[model samples]
Target: MRADVGRVAEALVEALPQPYGRWSIAVFDDPTPNAFALPGGKIGVHAGMLAVVRTPDQLAAVIAHEIGHVLADHSNERLTQELAVQGGLMLVDLFADEPGIRRLAVVASSRDIDV
Candidate 1:
């Protein structure tokens, strides 16, 4: 864990709307450059990121962006959207009057949806 990571993360949490848990920041010794902030306030960094990000400000920027995702609940929003689509397709599969429409719904929902 780095001082700048803790300092920026603590500062950002103070302005968050609700109470957040104690934050944990840790580093993984990997060759990939990436970082993530989980729902429970656990944040991880790949050691290789230091080579790519260069400055403390750059690292802070990455952490802030990931924190924004957790704060906004973007993951749940995406899951809800998928569930709604699946439910709509299920309803069509059960109740649609036209066989063609039902088949289309089934085929659409079964396809590999790359989001």
Candidate 2:
């Protein structure tokens, strides 16, 4: 499994070069059919995933998908978006006493509109 992951990773790196750090693959003994990739080229695969995947190519596809997420910096993007939303909510709460802003917030929340 390690060799297979290494080969697929090497091919992917050659195909889509990035300034990512060293790639490391870890297999967990969990029964859940899951896998994930973190920033900086860290990948993890659950043992049950092998049972669910029938072919090496399928495994490669899974690994590639996870790698794509890391390459795109999805985690950081999600974090930034969440922080921005939280900050906006905090600002709205802080200014809830102001008449205009409070009315806007009430209308936006009641109608599920983005404000």
Candidate 3:
């Protein structure tokens, strides 16, 4: 991650409300044209996104969109909904023992569902 990107992330986090201290951001070196924010305020931006985003505002738009989902508690809702629909309440506790569950949740939630 570039120092400037890190600074931008820090600034964005500072501008957020309430659970500000829980947030973190990272820039991945991959060239995949993607970015995502995980639950608990983890954000990841891909190198390809940086290359194509064109301006700080555009980049901010991408980051802000991800942050919006986090702020909206979409993942938690999705998890709960998925559990109910799948009748996976018995397996819900598995998330506590599975790091992969959290990672998958973040990735799934970060996807642009509207697209």
lDDT of each: 0.71, 0.73, 0.72
TM-score of each: 0.58, 0.65, 0.64
Q: Report model 3's TM-score to 2 decimal places.
A: 0.64
**Model 2: how far residue 1 lies from native, Å:** 5.2
Show model 1 residue runs off by greater than 4 Å. Answer: 1-3, 14-19, 81-115
The residue-by-residue lDDT of candidate 3 on 1-115, one tens digit each, is: 2556777776677787665447777889998988876788888888888888877777777888888878887777767766653554345555577766656655664444423
Alpha carbon deviation, residue 111, candidate 3 (Å): 7.1
Off by over 4 Å in 3: 84-115
lDDT of 2 at 11: 78
Tens digits of lDDT, candidate 1, 29-110: 8878888667667778788776688677788787777777666665666577668767886887678777788667656754
lDDT of 3 at 7: 70
Return the top candidate by lDDT: 2
Native-vs-model 1 lDDT?
A: 0.71
